[model samples]
Target: MLTKRLFSSSSASPNLFKIGSILKQTRTFTDADVLGYSELTHDANPLHFDAECAKDAGFNDRLVPGMLVASLFPRIIAAHFPGAIYVSQTLHFKLPVYIGEEIIAEVQATSIRRMKNKYIAKLSTKCIKCNGPLVIDGEATAMLPSLVIEPPNLASASS
Candidate 1:
């Protein structure tokens, strides 16, 4: 017989490498939030803001596009992960995120590898809410200026 329990599958971990991640938490994904980002990033993708366009495209409503969720890296890096530069990111969408739906996005370090002067952080990401489990799972690699070489939080200094 098989028993069912939460977190029985993949083990979720935290990101740790250059030392500045102080910490963070889950957050909601909002239409207004995404729309504002679209304007700032100058990426006026209809899927993020145009509800009608999204509906026509087969979404229940204005779905938060993939790229938008991927953008969470920036917010994560800025908010709590204070010393990393996103070098590569890959996310597999399991479902669509409708406008106004709250999403829990997380990036936990799975492992770390050394590369030149910087380091690579292998992370596991997920976006989950009332709809059930995560709608997406992602892996990301970031190149960071190590405090081991410079100072603490130096990654955010350039911004």
Candidate 2:
């Protein structure tokens, strides 16, 4: 079951994040996506690169590599919290994904605490298909700087 949460807030200066903050992104896996990942990782596993081989091996179809699916997790984190440094992540592969399947990655900020000079956020993360089957589930810990830094003006630097 996919339950979408609604948030309404009007704050002039928003904090970097808050507990319960959520981010979700969905992407449809493509043949190009699988091939590109395989080329990048040098993982030519028959299941990922060769559809005929995959079918022969008994999978319903060519399966998307687990890491390829899990990679979407970081996009959600970065979208919500840029410059947040990932300290650790634990991922569990729950289901096989096939080409052209849309998968959604959702992450929620579970805990935010000050650890020394930096703030650490613990996130509850999960990826699911459009039909609600779990593909990946795990937790991630990220360190957010206590102070946000504004980027320097490139024009000034170039002059």
Best by lDDT: 2
Which whole-number lDDT from 0 to 100 does residue 131 have in model 1?
59
Off by over 4 Å in 1: 1-24, 42-45, 49-52, 114-118, 144-159
Per-model lDDT:
0.59, 0.71
Q: Alpha-carbon error at 124 in model 1, in Å?
A: 1.5
| True-structure lDDT of candidate 1 | 0.59
Evaluated against the true structure, the overall lDDT of model 2 is 0.71
Candidate 1, position 61, lDDT: 78
Positional deviation of 7 in candidate 2, in angstroms? 17
Q: How close is candidate 2 to the true structure, as a TM-score?
A: 0.76
Local error of candidate 2 at residue 42 (angstroms): 0.7
For model 2, residues 83-109, the per-residue Cα lDDT tens digits are 778888899988888998888887777
Collision pairs in model 1: 14-109, 15-109
